[model samples]
Target chain A: MHSFESLSKDFAAFFQKSHFPDQPASLYQPADYFLGLGGKRVRPVCCLMGNELFDEILPDTWQVATAIELFHNFTLIHDDIMDKAPLRRGMATVHSRYGEPTALLAGDVMLVVAYDYLNKVRSEHFHRIIQLFNRTAREVCEGQQLDMNFEKSETVSLDAYIKMIELKTSVLLAASLKLGAILGGAGEGNLHHIYEFGRNLGIAFQVQDDYLDAFGDPDKFGKQVGGDIMANKKTFLLIKALESADPALKAELDALLQSNHPDKVEKVLAIFRACGVDEWAKTLKDQYLSAAFQHLDDIAVLSKRKEPLRSLANFLVQRDY
Target chain B: MHSFESLSKDFAAFFQKSHFPDQPASLYQPADYFLGLGGKRVRPVCCLMGNELFDEILPDTWQVATAIELFHNFTLIHDDIMDKAPLRRGMATVHSRYGEPTALLAGDVMLVVAYDYLNKVRSEHFHRIIQLFNRTAREVCEGQQLDMNFEKSETVSLDAYIKMIELKTSVLLAASLKLGAILGGAGEGNLHHIYEFGRNLGIAFQVQDDYLDAFGDPDKFGKQVGGDIMANKKTFLLIKALESADPALKAELDALLQSNHPDKVEKVLAIFRACGVDEWAKTLKDQYLSAAFQHLDDIAVLSKRKEPLRSLANFLVQRDY
Candidate 1:
C-alpha cells in the first residue's frame, strides 16, 4: 500500500503541472494566485486514496481530485469574503488582496472551471458525478448560510453546530471519497461506507481543529492559537463551555465572550479547562474518530487495501497542525 | 411553427410551475425572489423556440431552458452586487433587498440549481451541454471583468466594447439556443447556425437597448430615456462619437461626458447626432440583425419552421422597452 506521504506527493506534483487558463487576467489571475497559496490538499489526497484503494488510479480520478480542490478553493474565497478573514495559509486572502468583486468572480470562475473538469469524465460516470457534485455544492452553501446565522444567534445547540460542520466541511470530504470510489468502480455499498468514513473523519478533523486552535502549540499549529477564542467564534469549545457552565460561570463566560478583553483567549481557555470543556472536546474528537474507523472497517475491501486510509486517518487524528 | 407568443406563454407556465427547494431560506429565498420578479423570459423562450424549430419539445429541452434562465438570473444577482445597482425588473435588486452576502450565496445557489437542471439532461447530451455552459459561463465572467475594467479606463475602443458585450450579453443567449438545439437532436451545422443566430441577435438587441435608452420615449420605453447617457455608459453611440468626432466637437463631447451637466443627456444626444454616431449605431444594429437572419436562413430546416425565431428576432429588434 502506498503511504499517505507518497499519495500527497503525487497530488502535489499533478497539481503543480496542471494548467489553468491564463487569459481573462481579471477572472483567472486571482484563481491562480489563490491556488498557488498552498494548503495541505487533504481532500484531493483522500480522493486519490479512495480511488487507489479500489482500483488503479484512473485519469478521471485525477480530474475528480482536481475538481474537488478547485471547489474547496472556491468555497474558501467566498467564505473569506463573508467572514472578512484577512489571511489564509499565512498569506493574504483572495478577497483581501483582490477586491471583493474580483474575488467573487474568481470564486465563481473556479466553480465553472471545476465543473468543466468534472464534465470531462466519461459519459457513463458524468451524470452521477455531476449530480453528487451539485447536491454537495448546494449543501455547502446551506451550511455557510447556517454558519452565518449562528453569528447572530444567542445560543447554539451542540447538535445544530455539529450539523452545520457536517454540512459545511464533512459532506464535501465524504462526497470526495464517494466520487473517487464511483470512478474507481466501487460497489454501491462500498461507496456508502467510504462516504460515512469520510464524513465522520471530517467531523473529527474539525473538532480537532477547534481543539488545536485553543490548546495547540502555535509554532507547530502554523495558525494563531486561540484565534477563534479571541473572535468569540462559536466553536465546539465555546459552545460546550456555554452549555455546561454553571450560572455564575455561564454569566462570566458570556461576559468574556462579549468583551474585547485583551486576554480573552487566556480567559476563555481557563474557563474551558476549569469547566472540563477541554477534556470533553478531546473525548468528542475520539468518539468521532472511533466512529470513522468503524465505518472504514465496514467497507468490504481487503484490510491490506484499506491500510493507507487507516494510516491517514490515524495521522489526521494525531496531527499537531 | 409555433408563435413566439405561445412559446413565451409556455415558458412562463413552465417557470411558474417549477419548484425550487424552500429550505436554506437565506440562500434560496433570494433566488426565489429574483426569479419571481418577472422579466421577458427571453432566453428560455429562445431555448424553447430552438427546440421546436427542429423536433418536438423534449423533457430535456425544458431542463436546458430552465438552466439557462437560472444562469441568467445568477449573473444578474452577482452583477447587481458588482454594479451596486439598486433595481432590477422594476424592483429592488437581490443584493439591495437581501444583503450582499445573502445575495452572493443566492447567486451561487442559483448557479448550482442551474447545474442541477442541466444535470437532468440525458447523459448523451450532458457532456456537450455542460462543456458549452462552462465555456459560456467563463466568457461571461471575463466580459463582466472587462466591463468593470472599462469603468476605470479613460478610453474604450468600439471593437473592445462590442467584444465585451458579445461576451457578457450575447454568448449565453447563443448557448441557450444551442443547448436546446442539441437536445432537439439538431445537426452540428444547425447548432452552429442557431448559435450564430442567437449571438448576432443578442448584440442587436443590446444595441437597440442602448438606442432606446437614448432615443425612445420614456413612456413607451418603460425605462428612463438616456439613462445610459446620464450614467456616462460607453454605449455604441458614445464610443463611435469618440472615434469619429472632429477635434472641437470631440473636446466638447468629452467635456460633456465628464460633466454632471443638467442637460447632459440632451447635449450628448445632440453631439451623437452631429457626429452621426446615432446613425452609426442604427447601421451597426441593422448589420447584426441581417447577419442573424442570414444564419437563421442558413439552417437546413424549412424557412417556415424558422419563422418563430425570425419573428422573435424582429420583435427584439423593434422592441421599445
Candidate 2:
C-alpha cells in the first residue's frame, strides 16, 4: 500500500473540492472556510489504509473516506464552538471567523452530507455500517460529555481520565478503521480485531501527544508544546502524577500545578520528571501499544499483510507535530 | 384526541425521563433545564395531535413526538448563541448560564438524542421514518443558513423574506405533522396534504407572530411587544412597509430602520402603522391561513375526522394570546 499521508492528501483534495454544494451560498461559506483549513486527515486515511491492508476494493471508497473526514470536521466545528477555540489547524476556527450560528449550521450540514456519502455504499454491510455509524455517533457525544465533566472535577482518577480520552478522542479512529475494513469485505471477527488495534493504538497515540506537549521541541511541534501543563489540564501525566504522588510530594505537585508563575510549565514538567511520572506514562504507552499489536497479530491476516497497518500505527505514534 | 398542549407536555416529560441514565449528569442537564423552561411546545404537540387524529396505534409514537421537541430545543440553544440573546423563557439562556462551550456540547447531544428518539419507531414505518428524519434534519440546517444570510442583506425584498422565513421557521412544523401522519399510518396522498397544511400554517403562524409583535398589546403578549420592530428585524410588516413605501416614504422607512433611538421600537411601530403595514400583514396572514385550510379540505380523510385538527388551527391562529 502507498504511504497513508499521500493517500489522505489525495482524498483531502477530492473532498474539499466538493463540499456543501447544496447549501445557500453564504450559509455554506463557513463550512468551506473550515474545509480549506486542513488537518492531518488521520481518520479518513486510516480508513483507506485499513482497507488496503486487507484488499483493494472500490477506487471510490474515497467517498466513504470523505464521509469519515467530513464527520471529523463536523465534530471539530461544533467542538471548537464549545471549546472557545480561536484557531484550529493553524487557521481561524469557523465559529471564530463566521460566528457560532453559521458554524452550527455548517456542522449540521456536514453531518447530513456525511450520510449522503455513506448512502452510496453498495454492500450487504450497509445495514451493519449504519448501525455502527449511529452507535459511534452516540459514543462520540458521550465522550464529549465526559470530557466536559472532567473539567469540573477537582480530582480525576487515572482510569476515569483514560476512559474519557478513549471515548472522546479514540472511538472515531477505531470506527474509521472498522468502517474501511467492513467496506473491504472483511469478516466480523477480523474487523473487530482491526477496531481493537485502532482503539488501543489511538489511546497510546494520545498519551504520547500528552507526553510530547510537555517535552517536545516547540520548533518541531507546530503549536505550543506545554499547553496542557499551562492549562493544568488533566492529561495522562497529570492523572498519573496525582495518583502516584506521596503525601510529602503531593503538596509540591499541587503547588506547581496551582502556581501562577511565568515558569509554571517548566516547573510542572520538572516536578513530573522528578517524580518519575514521565517514566510511568511511557510504561503505560508501551502497554497500550503492546495490546494494540497483539490485536493486530490475532487477525487472520498474515504478518506481511499487516505491515502497512503497523506502519500507519508507528507513523501516528511517532509524529512530532 | 388530546389537547395539543397536553400531548406536548406528555411528550416533553417522557423525553426528559428517557434521556440519559445518570453519571456526569451535565450531558443531560441542559436538556432538562431547557425542557423545563418550556414554551407553547407548539411543534411536537402538533405532531402528537396529528397522530391522534388517526387511530391510537401505540405509545411509541410519543418517542417521535419527543424527538421533534428535542430537535426544536436543540435549535433554540444554538440559536440563542447566534442571536446573543441572554434570556429564554424568561430565564438565562444556555450559553449565558453554562457558557457557550457547554451549550454547544449540550446542543450537539440534543440533536443526536433527537435521532435516537426517531429511531424508536415501530418496525413497520421504520424505513420511511429514517428518510423523513434525514429530510427534516437537512432542511432545518438549510433554513438556518438562509436566516444567517438574511442578517447581511440590506434589501431583503418581500419575496426573499417570505422564502427565508418559510425555510427557517416552517419546515420543522411541517415535518413534524408529516412524520406523525406517516407513523399514524396515513396514506401518501393524505401525508402530502397534511404537510402542505402544516407548512402553509407554519408560514401563517410566523406572519401572525410578526403582526402581533407590532400591533398586539404588551400586557396581553408574554414577551416584549414590538420586539422585532425594536431590533429592525426583517418581518412581514417591515417587508410590506418597505415594499409599499413611496420614494419619500421609502427613504423615511429606511432611515427609521437604520435608527438607534431609545424609542426605536415605538418609532418603527408608528411608521409601520402610518404605512398601513399592519393591515397588509393581516392580509398576508389570511392568505396563508386560507391556503392552509384549503389543504386540510384536500386531505382524503373525512373532514369529520379532521374537525379536531381544525379546532387546533383555530386555537393557534384565532386566539389572542
Candidate 3:
C-alpha cells in the first residue's frame, strides 16, 4: 500500500529535467521556466499512482508523465493570453513578459514536442497510447471552448458549469490516470474506477480553487483573494448565489457586482455572508469531496493502496489557499 | 494523369464540403470566406497529383488530400492574426471579421481535428504517418517564431527568410505530399524525393507571392500592389531591395518605407521598379522554380505522369491573379 503522499512526493519531482532530445534554449529563458513553476504535478502523479496500484512500471514512464506536464503548460500559456492573467507562479505570465506572438508559438511548439515524446512509447502499445493521447487532447480543447462559452452567456446553470469544468479541467486529470493504467496493463474494470476517481477529484479540486480565490485568508492564500468576485466571474459561489438568492438579495448582489469602485469587493463579500453564500459554497465543496471519496472506495484495489489517493484528495479539498 | 487543372478543381471542390465532428459552426466559415476569396490550392493539388504519379486509383485518397488543405487553413488563420492582415482572398480576414479570440481557438481546433483524420488512417501505416505529421508540425511552429523575431529586428538576410519560409510554409506543403505518398505506401526514397519537390515548389510559390504583390497586375491580382512594402514587412522583395541597394539607394528605400502614407505605396513601387527590385525578385522566383523542376526530374516516375505537377507549379508561379 503506497500512501498517495509518498507517490505524489515522488512524482512532484517528476520531470525535474528535460528527458529527451538535445534541448533548445527556451528562447526566453529556462526552457523549463513554466515547467518549473511548481504545480502539484497532480494529474501526472495520478498517472503514476494508477500505475503503482496496478503494480507495473513501464520504462520511459517519464516520457508520458513529462508529456502530461507539457500539455498542461501549453494550455496555461494560451489560457493566460485569454484570461489576461499577468502573473503565474509569482512570475510574469509568458504572454505578459515575452509578448503574445512568442507565447502562442512557444505553446504551439510545446504541444508538438509533447507528441515527440509520445512517439517513443513501445510499439505494441503505441496505437492505443496515441489514440488515448488524441482523444484526451481533443477533450481538453473542447473543455476550453466550453469554458470560454460560459463567459459570454448571460447565465450558466450550476450543473452546466460543473460539466464544463469536468470536461475542461477534470478530464485531463481523468485521462492522466487512465493513460498510466493502459501503459501498466491494468484491467478494464480498474481503469474505469480509476478514471471515475480522478474526474470526481478534479471537479472537487477546481471547486476548491474557486472557493479559495474568494474566501481564503489574505496571508495564507499566497495571493489576493476574492479574484472571482472582483472579476465578476460566475463560479460556483456566484452561480449558487444567483440561483438561491431572493429577489431583494439578488438586486443588492447585482448592484454591488456592477459597481465600478474598488469597494465592490467588500460590498459583495458582505452580501455573500449575510445571505450565507460562503457557507453554502463551503458545503458544496465538501459534498463533492465526499462524492469523490465514494468513487475512490468503489475501486477494486485494496483499502491500503487507495489510502494515498484519499489523502491527496483530502489535502486538496482541505487546503487553505 | 490528372491535369493540373483537374487536380486543382478536384481537390478544391472536395475540401469545400464539411466533414469532422465537434467543429464549431464558425470554424470553417472563414475557410469559405478565405478559400472562396480564391488563391490556388496548388500545394494540396500537388499532393494528389504526386500520389497519383506513384500509383493510380489511390484509396480513400480524398481524406489525406483534405488534411493538407485543413493544415494550410490552420496556418493562414494564425498567420492572419500575427500579420494583423485585414484581408485574405480579397475578403475580410478571419481575425478581422470574427475577432481574434474566435479566430485563435478555431485555428487551434482545426489542427486537432487534422490529426483526428490522421488517426483514421489504416492501423499499419498510422505510426509512420503520425511521425511525419509531428515533425512537420514542429518545424512550422519554429518557422513562425523565427518570422515573428524578424519583424522586430532590422536585418533579415535573404537566406534567413528562405529558411523561415521553408519551415513556415514549405514543409507543410512537402508534408502534404509526403502524407499522400505514405497513404499510398510509396517507398521511403520516393517519399523523400517527392517531399523535396513539393518543398521547393512551396518556396517558389511564396517567392511568386512576393513578386506579384509588388509586380503583379493589381486589377487582375485583386489587391493593392506593394502592400507588404508599405507595411515594412520583411518579404523577399524588401530583403532583395535592401541587399541590392547602394547605401544611398538603401537610405532612399528606408525613408520611403518609414512614412507609411497613402502615397507611400506608389512611391515605394517607383523606387523598387527603378532599382530593378521586381526583376531581382522575379529572377529568384524563376531560380526556385528551376530548382523545384530539377527535384521533380529526380523522381523515378515517368515524365508523362509528372505533367500535372510541372504545370501546377507553372500555373502557381505564372498566375496573374
Candidate 4:
C-alpha cells in the first residue's frame, strides 16, 4: 500500500501535464494558472488510496483521480468569486488576478474538462461513476448555497451547520473515495464503509482545522491563528459556543461579532474558553475521528492493508496546521 | 415524423417535472425559475426530431432531450451572469433576480442535474453521448470567451467572428441533434450529416437573427430594432461592413462605434447599407441555409422522413424574429 505522501507525489507528477488546450488563452490560462497554484492534492490521493484498498490501482483510477482534483479546483475558483476573496493559498485568486468573467469561465471549463476525463474511464465503470459524481456535485452546490444562507441568518443550529459542512466539504471527500473504490471493483458493502470513513474523516479534519485556527501557534499553523474569528466566519467552535453559552456570554459574543475592534479575536477566544468551547471542540473532533476509524475497521480488508489510510487519517486530524 | 411544434409540446410536458430538489431554495429556485421562463425549447425538440429521422423516438431520447435542455439553460444562467444581462425571455435573468452568487450556484447545480439525466440513459449509449456533450460544452465556453474577447478588441476578422458564433451558438444545436440521432441507432455516416445540418442551420438562423435586429419590423421581431447596435454588439452585418467598407465609410463606422449618440444605430446602419452589407448578409444567410439543406438531403434516410427537419430549418431562418 502506498503512503499518502508517496501517492500524492505520484498524483502530482501525473497531474503536471496540462488538462486544457492552449488556445483561447484568456479562458484556459487562468485555469492552468490556478491548477498550478496547487494544494496538497489530498482528495485525489484519497481516491488513489481508496483504489489501493481494494486492489492494485487500475489505470482508470488515475483518470478519476484527475477528475476529482479538477472538480475540486473548479469549486475553489467559483467559490473564491462568490466569496469575493482576494487570495487563496497565499496568492492572488483567479478572480483577483484574471478578473471575474475570465475566472468564471475558467471555472466552467475546468468542470467540463473534469467530465472529459471521467468520460475517458472504461465504459464498464463509467455510468456508476458519473451518477455518483452528479449526485455529489449537486450536493456540493447545495452546500455552498446553504453556507451563503447561513451568513445572513441570525441563528444557525449546530445540526444545520454540520449538515452544511457535510454537503460543502465532506461529501466530495466521501465521493472521491467511493469513486476510486467503484473503479477498483469493490463490492457495495465495502463501498459504504469507505465512504463513511471518508465522510467522518473529513468532518474530523474540519473540526481540527477550526480548533487550530482558534488555539494553535500562528507560526506553526502558517496562518493568522484567529482569521476566522476576525472575519466573523462560522466554524464549529463559534457555532457550538453560541449554542452552549450563557445569556451574558452569548450577548458578549454577539457584540464581538458586530465589532471591528482589534481585540475581537482575543475577546472571542476568551468567551470560547470561558464556555469550554475549546475543550468541547477537541471532544467533537475525537468523536468524529473515532467514528471514522470504526468505519475504516469495519471494511472487510486485512488491517495491514489499511495502514496507509490509517496513518493518513492520523496525519490529517492530528496536525496543528 | 414529429413536427417541431408537436415535439415541442411533448418536451414541454415531460419537462414540467422539476429537475431539482426543494431543500435549498436559494440555489434550486433560481434554476427552476429560469427554466420556468420558457424560451422556444428548440434544442431539445431538435433532439426529438433527430431521433424520429432515423427510427421511432425512444424513451432514451426524452432523457437525453431533458439533458440537452438543462445543459442549454445552464449556459444561459452563467452567461447571463457573465454578461450582466438583466432580462431573459422578457423576465429578469437569474443573476438579476436572485443575486450573482445564488445564480452561479443555480447554474452549477443545473449542470449537475443535466448529467444526472444523461446518466439515466442506457449504458450502451451513455459513453458516446457524454463524450460528445463534453466536447460541445467546452467549445461553447471557448466561444463565449472569444465573444467577450472580441468586445475589447479593436478589430475582429469575419472568419474569427463566424468561428466564435459557431462555438457559442451552433455547436449545442448540432450536438443536440447528434445525441438524439445516436440514441436512435443512427449509423456513423448519418450522424455526421445530421450534425452538419444542425450546424449550418444554426449559423443561418443566427445570421437571420442579426438581420432582423437591424432591418425587420419591430412589431414582427418582438424586440427593438437596433438593440444589438445600441449595445455595440459585434454581429455579422457590423463585422462584415467593417471589413468591406471603404476608408471613408470605415472611419464613419469607427466614430459611430465610439459614440453613444441617439442616432448611432442609424449611422451604423447607413454605413452598413453603403458597404452593401445588407445584401451581402442575405447572400451569406442563403449560403448557410443551402448548405444546411444539402446536408439534410445527404442524410441516409427516406426523403419523406426529412420533411419535419427541412421545414423547421425554413421556419427558423425565414422568420423575421
lDDT: which candidate is best? 4
lDDT tens digits, residue span A215-308, model 4: 9998888888999999888999999999999999999999989999988988999999999999888888999989999999999999998999
TM-score of chain A of each: 0.95, 0.95, 0.90, 0.98
Comparing 1 with 4 on DockQ, the higher-scoring candidate is 4
Off by more than 4 A, model 1: A17-19, A319-321, B17-19, B319-321
Clashing pairs in 3: A4-A308
State the lDDT of candidate 2 residue by residue for A55-125, as single tens digits: 88466466678888888899999888778899897789987898777888889878877766775666656
- Please estimate how well model 3 matches the true structure, expressed as its whole-model Cα lDDT: 0.75
Descending-DockQ candidate ranking: 4, 1, 2, 3
What is the C-alpha lDDT profile of model 3 across A1-321, one tens digit per residue?
566667667766656765323422434342356666777777777777667676755665556877787888888887887777899888888878877777776777677677777767764666676677777776777677667778888889999899888878988988888888788777788888888878878888888788778788888778788777888888988888888888998999878777867788777778777778788777777777777787778778778877767777777678333
- Local distance difference test scores for all models: 0.88, 0.79, 0.75, 0.91
Residue B194 displacement (Å), model 3: 1.4
Per-candidate DockQ vs. reference: 0.83, 0.48, 0.47, 0.87
DockQ of prediction 4: 0.87
User: Top model by DockQ, which number?
Assistant: 4
Question: Model 2 misses residue B235 by how many Å?
Answer: 1.5
For model 4, chain A alone compared with the true chain A gives a TM-score of 0.98
Better of 1 and 3 by DockQ: 1
TM-score per candidate, in order? 0.97, 0.88, 0.90, 0.98
Window of ten residues with lowest summed lDDT in model 4 chain B? B312-321
Instruction: Give one digit per residue, the lDDT tens place, for model 1 in B211-315.
Output: 889988888888999889889888888888889999999999989987999999999899989998777778888899999999999999888898888888888
> Candidate 3's error at B38, in angstroms?
7.1
